[model samples]
Target: MAVRYIPYYPDTLEGQARLDNFVRTSRMLFYKDNNQVKTRIQRGMPLYEVTESETVGANPDGNIVMHGECLSTCAYLKDKGIEIDLVYIDPPFASGADYAKKIYVRRNPLVQKAINEAEQQLDNSDMQEFEEKMYGDIWDKEHYLNWMYENLMAIKSVMSDTASIYVHLDYHIGHYVKILMDEIFGEENFRNEIVWCYYGPGSPGMRNFNRKHDTIFWYSKSEDYQFNDKDIRIPHDAKTLDNFKKGLDGSGFISENYDLDQNGKIPEDWWEMAIAGRFPKDGVKRVDYATEKPWALLERIINASSNEGMLVADFFGGSGVAAAVAHKLGRKFVHNDVNINSIQTARDRLVSAGAEFTMMEVRDGVRLFRNPVQTMEKLVRLIPGLNTETNLDKRFWAGSIYDSQKGKMPVYLPNLMDSSSRVMDKTEMNHIIREALPDLGNDVKQIVVYYIDVEDIEELRQFIHDENTQTDIAIELRDLKQVLDDVVIEDKATWEMSQVQVELFTKWQIKMLTFHSDYVMKKIEAFNLIGDQQHQKKLANNKKSTFKPIKISDEGLECIEWLSVDCTNAQKDAPWHSDAEVKIDKTGTVTVNGTKTRNLWDATIQSDDKPLRLKVRNICGDEVLFVL
Candidate 1:
């Protein structure tokens, strides 16, 4: 279980003075959890490779794509003595906005529209496109500051002496973080506050000027750092070039022999580039992931800060534009994010660029909890006999179950959305005995506690034995993993493997005939129910409603987003080595093995080696591996 440590939030003037003095004296901010986090920083977080995934035309030294929290990830990097040269982190801005990814059903162009009025009439509810929340940015100011303090300290330890870091933020709480960055990186190392300007349609209501830009704070680790001044220069406009050539002053901006690099002039601290999805329906640079930065923005930062062979890292890497751009520019990269979508999207983008990297997780005992929010929502029905009928204290009991032998049993479940609560430790167990047990009603004969991870099973068992209760009520502990072992509804698939002669050469081909995701169907049904309710409300108000449920094409390929065949081995535990792969983007554009292909999926893949297994990723980024 993760140890509990409350961070020192400066809430008052005295508290602020204490924090600032601590920073001046210790050269680090105050975090009550610092010792716990520092232990991992000094040692390291346990990391294991999920799959090798790629090795084609990759750096010999290797690139890393990690899935975990930023502070823990930095700890692992620090323990390995891996010094990063450039770091760009676009972390949670504490903007009170919960960003979500737009999940779209793939369009199967090969299928013909079905003209079945009877079938359509039976299911009148519609399946509108849904957005899945990636992560919550809402937080108390104190809590947010505490979290950022620990992360900044951890990240700084792994940076090289000549490294540079860029912290991206906006007007929401950027001013507060600017002070923190000054304390962490030192005031002397403070460099430029880059203003990234962009534009969009304004709101209809009258208000002040629209806030349409983000702030990027760049700082260096030391007095001397890498800055490719010549490589990042901007091209001069036509008028400026004419003025220089005609020996005329450039409107008082240019003097005699005021020579700049022949390449271009040095750009100012401000940049004008639109955010992702702002482009004209994805002009080859837009990735569908939320808050994805433009490739050109990353390209400029990478070119200006680091050299070709140096390592670049992004801890809060959302869509992985930083890593992809780094790899494209002949630099090694390390990308880490807790969201599976971020990791999967970034991994696919890198693969599309023919870059290789090692995929790994921090081994938090949450193999299937990559998206814990949705998992928690599904737990209510998954657990047998569970109901929200707890007669006892609601604070401690999430729900209760009725058993013939045991009577009424209240159940306690950790909040899977919060990482801190997923684990069961000494402190949590002690609280259960002291606070929870006292609140239990007389009818409660038993109580069940579920934990995703634990500190020590034997110690916990002994703790229960040592602690006595005023009542004879029994307490039971169970491993949540055992209950959630079959949590993911596996997708059923049918395929044929045979030898096909193409261009006089016999090659093995695999054709996917049909596919079905039970999870996807259930999600559609849920959306249909909501649509039905909305339709009824509109009709009650005497408004005409044309509510049609979203229907899957007859081909049933709309649920799939990615497919790959691992020809190397059937070793399920090892890193996956894809012999052939295909992915469908938001626009239904199919890409085969890092190259753009036709607009529609061919439903077949060719491979030189015999296919060993198949990996299919649904539209929601949930994946299932099948033996071929």
Candidate 2:
């Protein structure tokens, strides 16, 4: 749904008529063809991406967003198939204007202490810069609504059948945003307008009553929601617990004046907890970001409404206190925020408690959260060739999968079809075969071939034999089949190596390498090489490591190479002879080899007679000379 807010419509007819007098500004987001992911990568930045899984179950997966605007934590959870059981959003309080306090060294000393602590916790330098940028800056209430609306709409999609949504807001735009939520989530789902009351020093605005409490609007996606009241019950009042003393003769004096039950008394809706500075000594303070809710408060909400493994989403994951509470309680969390500083602060807090998170941005510039390991696993399942064999959890490099018992099966393998007589068959193909074969027992004698191609079964069969020639290998050829009836075994003379098999396998091998040559190198080099440029140097300095070469698959290579060559090698002929530019799989063996071609550099160079012209227009209405 499109972003909805009161600002979208004029509040009065006078306001409507004067709408044209307002500033007409447009924020256009253009989706780039490139995927540089410029926002979050930097030196000392916490490696939030789950590159490895913990062998021991010490750390759990959590999602944290920093910097970019967030539209929907629920939608993000839905994308990952993590059904959210509850959503706790403490959006910006629209008290006429959004208020964000400063947390910088230049600010007050208390604020500086908080900033210093936050900075120490952050490992990423680029992220640190982002925090600095947001330091003291506050947003307009209208902007906050626009930001909240865009993200909350996406979040609604990720709620489970029995999910509940709780929104915490102060007197500001609490009623306004509530009306929006009622319309968006349906008025029937509205559960309660929980009044969180606290007695505090009254504000100086004596003309009106002092506002000492905030409102929490509780709503559910469906009538059936997860509300475990027992989890949030409070200890019985001293007087109530002592009632048993009068009722029962042998009741302990500890319960002298109140009635005591084995189970705790359910806390009332208007229950009061220690507010802010008055919290228990053991309770932590939210010194960095002002207006942060207490952990105990969030704990009550989470424990009372969510299951152990159920996802808990927080779109306005402010200082991340809610996320931290969720982690401590053993529930997965998908936390989002537009402010980069908030995400960084949240991440530092979560990581200290031993949780990992991955970050992504949506189309509308909102940052999102996901479990990194889960994300990687899903990608592998969807794209077959993206196997993480070497670094079981690392990104995929172009390679084939071989089963000693079931032969070799290449899924989305490269297309490097070449015909070369001197191609190394046994050594190259043997290497791949050895690598692909999962370690069965050493004494296993039977052998079989499982080729996974509907179109080129014969080529795969020949390729297998071309590498294992004269080995006394007894092989059963299983044609690639998605179903039993789809199998087709060509009538080859023998199961062992043949000249036709060798020739065909060689060509198929070449085709495979050619297809994924660029991508393979990009992956390997990303882990090994560094880009040379001013911005890259800054990135390296901030990241403490070279940025991995972003993936440039065969599909994306045409565009990347065009940009690279057009800018750097404009004078030199476009060269294609670099072996580094391509991969070759031939005759059961693989090699990185190719030839470069010298071609015209530019349109003018390609057309010898082409001319360039430059014209200048004078500011004083005089035309300058044109050069050709």
Candidate 3:
């Protein structure tokens, strides 16, 4: 358990000490705080329920899609006593790398302005594209181990005794995680260290062999785990067939019988496949998500590990490939991700598969900023004079702002990663007054705290005043909503609905006319502002640089990443449902329902139900609902 007995154990003293420190800290994680997830679950946590009564077709309520962090979703499932037959998670590789999604501004060719500009040969190719950080895999080794440990334990608690878990990771941190998995699932239950091999063009200056394969450590919960070898058999190669024809067996490695099942031979632990969307000619369907995996890889894993109608889960759920494949193969699934963009992408992907599933959220309170990394990144831009470049980069302090009148005020942004930290009550106030404020040093005259919620303002003030006898540092509280309110704008779009008959079938059709995303335009404006400053500097200094600014046509339907119509009647204060939808990728490729087409949009969506509400998601994941 201490990781001392690993193969080829480091003999050096320093290596041994580092490993000791890691093991020490990792064991401490056993007692680490989970922020009262168990207590919350005892108040009736819901596990996923798939209407698994499948006979001949897909069941709409037989699958589940969740919008939540991995831990919270796992906790919900474990609390509900839901058991998974197989799990395939392609989690972050912890390589300290940041991945981003290409954001595009949509073009509406049907609009009058777009039509006239197109007839006049307005070059749409000059439109610039930008990327938004989807997630960051920057984690300290010990912290990454701790997080992974917690997640694996939670996942194991929800797995059946005969279930299998395939953790797909690259070369960066897979070795360390394998040790943790060994501890959690037991070393004897370890099945295979599958190597998924692929080829891609590398730089000419490359000095080493390209990391063309990813490691997938397959572990079973128990010895009785399912594995249908024939489900994923490959055909015998020509050389092997010839050798068998000549009455020569290739020794112990090859089976004695050349009649090794006429169907084919079982594939080896290593697989030669292709990455998703890398080669357009390879014909892999893609959603353009930053870290999506290929479908073929998942199909083989699912086919081998789980039978038809078994429940599978992917908590990371990037692009929902695992869940989608499970549903396609007649298996139930639960897909979860914390990011809204990921959830939306997965939702659209599942819909295209005609999957019948209910969308659920981990009820761990409302998220103001949602994720920690992006929250800090946005705070630098959201707050005008806030600076994070300070020696006081303590745990609670978000950053500091220098004011001539007030001196230095350390800003406090709620830890979005922790649910209990979102709301600032007397408990949080006490922690700040006693713990966080003392560390800020006497130089800090005021400690500014921004909170999403407070139990009672008067009570909090009284508690702060009563508890502030030790420190003279004043507490200035500000509502996070007030600071972030102006930044969140409701996007505007125009759409209409009509009854269209297709092949004598009564269908409700909705057409997207134009869309204006303040989120997209704000980023574009900020981008252009930087360009303007560069232009001014160049004019003054007489220099030149290549920086293209983003331009948009009047009708901005192209900004719409995915649009849907809730043909299911929208009752009073009822939740929205996606009945018919269309998605536009970065290259302006349009995907309607689940069908991909190179034809012009015609800007229409059709469904058997009547169109009641319209939902449009911008490229940056900001959504606005319109009542039809």
In order of appearance, the predictions have TM-scores of 0.80, 0.42, 0.79
Per-residue lDDT of 200-301 in model 1, one digit per residue for the tens? 888899498988999999999889988898888889889877777776654644676677457988889999987752322322355777788888788888
lDDT of each: 0.74, 0.43, 0.72
lDDT of 2: 0.43
Candidate achieving the largest TM-score: 1
Candidate 3 steric clashes:
5
Q: Residue 427's C-alpha lDDT in candidate 1?
A: 62
The lDDT of model 1 is: 0.74
Show model 3 residue runs off by greater than 4 Å.
1-61, 111-128, 245-250, 253-259, 277-284, 368-372, 383-385, 394-396, 401-407, 414-439, 445-487, 495-514, 529-548, 585-589, 602-610
- Index of the highest-lDDT prediction: 1
Model 2 off-target regions past 4 Å?
Answer: 1-67, 72-75, 101-150, 243-261, 277-285, 360-628
RMSD of 3: 7.5
RMSD of each: 6.3, 29.0, 7.5
